[model samples]
Target chain A: MAAIKGFGAYLPEQVLDNAALAAEFGVEPAWILQACGIETRRVAAPEETVVDMAEKAARACLERIGMEAGALGGIIVGTGTPHRQFPGVSASLQQRLGVVGIPAFDIHLASVGGFFALATAVELCERYGPILVVGAERMSQVMAREPRVKESAILFGDGAGACVVAPGEGPVTVLDIKMQSDGTFVDDLSMEFGSTLNMNGRTVILQANRKLRQSLTELLERNKLAATDVNLWLFHQANVNLLKQVGQALGIPEDRVFLNLPRYGNTSAASLFIAATEAQAEGRMNPGHAVMAAFGAGMGWGSALLRVQ
Target chain B: MDIRAAVRKAIQDMAQAPLPADDSASLFTGGVIDSFGLMDLMTNLEEILGVKVPDSELMPSRFETVDKIVAYFQARK
Candidate 1:
């Protein structure tokens, strides 16, 4: 069984409210918020880099476990915002965590990077021992300096999150995972210039809804878990519309879907971990229930079913 | 202040600190400026140099180097 031993996250200090962004773009905040499930997004400080945020999250997770970073068998970072294209953010994190001799790597699946990264950590735990997975991004770095992509400018924020996963027998375990992708949908959500971020709203929404609903159904059926078994449905916090559509499609009930998109916009890869952290802190993931979900870019998506305890 | 010099000074102030001794070097390629750092450059041009830089001018190619940024501002003037 795979158990989440600890978790932590860092949200940027400034909040770009939906109303403020709406006024800036001459759009209606109510419509935008209702459609996107996003109200405010965090912007990173000039001094902060992708590596810096990831390091802070890694520190937080390690501190939570009452263990040192050196205790981990490996480190994995999920990000599309590496400070440099060549050096994997995970390698940088391992250096910062002082885990010099472990296998560390980075994966860039846009929003779904976190899920893919976590799945890799789960695989490592199956092969070796416990592992630390960190999903971090400094996306404000990719925002156009002149507010060119006003919709995107107002949509993205920067942050990081970390979780410690260990191989153990527990009531709470990662039951199953399902990931799928179609490169044809790649253009649906992407950044055009500088290999950064450029999203086509209509297409991204349509494809995400299709994939999310399909994946959620398959995951539930394969695990033999009913919708009623899921205590918390943590989908990627893309926008309000996608959340509503997915919830309605799956019959998971709106109350079961954990949403903070209105508060944080889309932190890309960091969304799920942050949601998990908040849900746990809020006592939403009590024992004797289950949690299920999917998310992110490359138009990539994955869903994980977990037993709650 | 002359328009060209104002543009030049704006470029200098926003260029990576300890401005490259030679202005021909590409700011981004030289590791002196990044996409976020370009924000300070854009803001300096807008607020200090009294230029309204529209969103379109934020492209990577246009603002790759100090010379290019100055050229962009001068052309707008």
Candidate 2:
């Protein structure tokens, strides 16, 4: 078993409202909000990159864990967007931290990246030591700067979130994770370019909804757990409506769903970690309580039953 | 093998399968090549062709299908 040593999140200072996007794209705000469930989203400034946001989040986590950079066994940054084509974001972060010897790498799980990255970190920590896992994405860079009314553009934000995990026999332990993939329907929800997000609303909903329900149920049953056992449900903040629909189908109460979409659209890989941080800060989780969930891009989906520390 | 077939084989291996049924449509637009799948494809292209596909060239239009991928390499050659 391993414990989450610390957690941190960073939301850029900028906020853009649906009305602003609607006016820019010649679409009604109500339509966008009703269809996407996004009222506002965060945007990174020109000076901020995915790596920059990740650093801030990782620093906060390191500070909370009371560990120096040199103590880390590994650093895994989960993101699809990188500052460049080579020398992954994780390597740059390792260099910036001046932790020269530790192993570092970047993963491209897209939205479900946070969980996937965390899962990988747990494995690395078991084999090595404490790991710093960061999910940072600058989705704003992919937004269409000129076309004000693009549907997919209105549904994402830029930010980063991180957590430090160490081996411990704590009450909070990662129990089980159910990951499912159906590559046959890959074209439904995706980015059209390195700089642009392209999503087919109908297809993404169908795929996400079906898989999310099935996986969550199987994970809970396999672990011999019930939905009532969970204190929080930190879902991937991809689509506001999608989250709502998935929640409704799962019979999860609205309060259990930690939402930052109004403030940070879809942060992609950063969404879940940020939600968990907020939950902890609000004192919503305690030992013995379970945190159950799902997230990422394959539109990959994973559900983990975690015991609170 | 010709460039087109070679590119197709490269993508097939990257996806861990034979060529997808429709090899002409855009992979991104068609949703067949996802971010992870695309990364896998890029790694194959770099290793197989011995040419680095720049980050800027990782768009849907460029690697939509086996034909387009081969064309990209052909032009580069």
Candidate 3:
């Protein structure tokens, strides 16, 4: 079975503290903290592209595994905020990593894109040997000052996380990955091409809670495991309260959940892997079963189960 | 607990702040509750009132205030 041999993440050095946002929006800093549990988030510099973050994260992952870029058989980048419209971020990442001519592509599933890309990598590993999967986003670039869009602007950050999926035994063996989407709620949260993001915050909250719970349940059932079996629960860092509610609904203990939203806000596609990598760094992830779940625009949601090796 | 009291309690517990004594105070427009707080209120209401709010009826207006939430659920019963 394909396993996550190594994992890495990168957050921009610049931090956008909630106090600054509160002052800019004329709201209480406590309100922003209470509403989403985000105290600060990373902001990308003007010159930092999605590929830049992806390359750093990918390099970290490769370094942890002590592997060279030339050893990669394929590359998959999951992102909704690509630097260019035509050539996916993976293309540039391939060139930067000196792994050009390898199969490279991007998945645009927004927040849940990381899980989808990892699932694809698991399958591609059979044909390609070892695959580099990166979930990166420069969400700050899309932030707009429009009144209606301000809330979303506060909710997103720029970051990237990557994992090296290869044919080997490691700390985590991917058991299964399941994904689903409903187009009806596509309008609930979206950014049309060339435009800024717009969202029905209330609707998206309700839909995200429902979809994440449903997907996580299905994944657990298929794996013949119960929620309690998951030792480490890495959910997309969307909102702290939403994650708490979903964990409560699933009967998962609060301590089992790993959250970094307070520091990173919502990094969209990069959220899950970033949390995973952080959990590992914190020594929270042990040799046991773990689950990762995410929900995003396209009303897409997915969950992946892993057995810690 | 009475429906109004239960609703108020839920809001207070979830928001960690007491609602205005006046029942007519706006919950949504006044920023008394955000979307996340609304979800918590729903879960608490379901448990306290012993009723499931159908997804179809989960709208902002129906629970815009403490009185409105109490009245809506009472009417449903």
lDDT by residue (tens digit), candidate 3, A180-288: 7788767768888768787888878877876787788888888889999899999889988888889988999999999899999999999988998899999988988
Error of 1 at A299 (Å): 2.4
- Distance from true position, residue A91, model 2, in Å? 0.9
2 or 3, greater by lDDT: 3
| Candidate 1 per-residue C-alpha lDDT over A1-309 given as tens digits, one digit per residue, 9 for 90 to 100 | 687787788887877787877787788888667545676788888888888888888788788778787788888888877788777898877877777777888987678888888888877787767788888878888874554566677677788888887787453577776677667656557765465456755456555666677788888888787777788887767676667766775787788889877788788888788887777778787775555455666767888888775
Instruction: Provide the DockQ value for model 1.
Output: 0.01
Please, what are the lDDT tens digits per residue for candidate 2 over residues A7-97? 8998899888988888877889998887667788888888988888999899988887688988899999988677887788899899888
Model 3 residue A19 CA deviation in Å: 2.1
Give the share of true interchain contacts found in each model. Answer: 0.00, 0.00, 0.23
Error in Å for residue B21 of model 1:
68
Model 3 clash pairs are A171-A309
Which consecutive 10 residues in model 1 chain B have the weakest lDDT in total? B53-62
Off by over 4 Å in 1: A26-35, A145-147, A192-196, B1-77
- What is the Cα-based lDDT of residue A5 in candidate 2? 80
The TM-score, computed over Cα atoms with residue i paired to residue i, of candidate 1 is 0.76
> For residues B24-62, what per-residue lDDT tens digits would candidate 3 score against the true structure?
888866777877678778877888888888655666667
TM-score, cand. 3: 0.84
The prediction achieving the highest TM-score against the true structure is 3
The better-scoring model by DockQ among 1 and 3 is 3
Error of 3 at A162 (Å): 0.2
**Residue A30 alpha-carbon offset, candidate 3, angstroms:** 1.9
Query: Chain A in model 1: its TM-score?
Result: 0.93
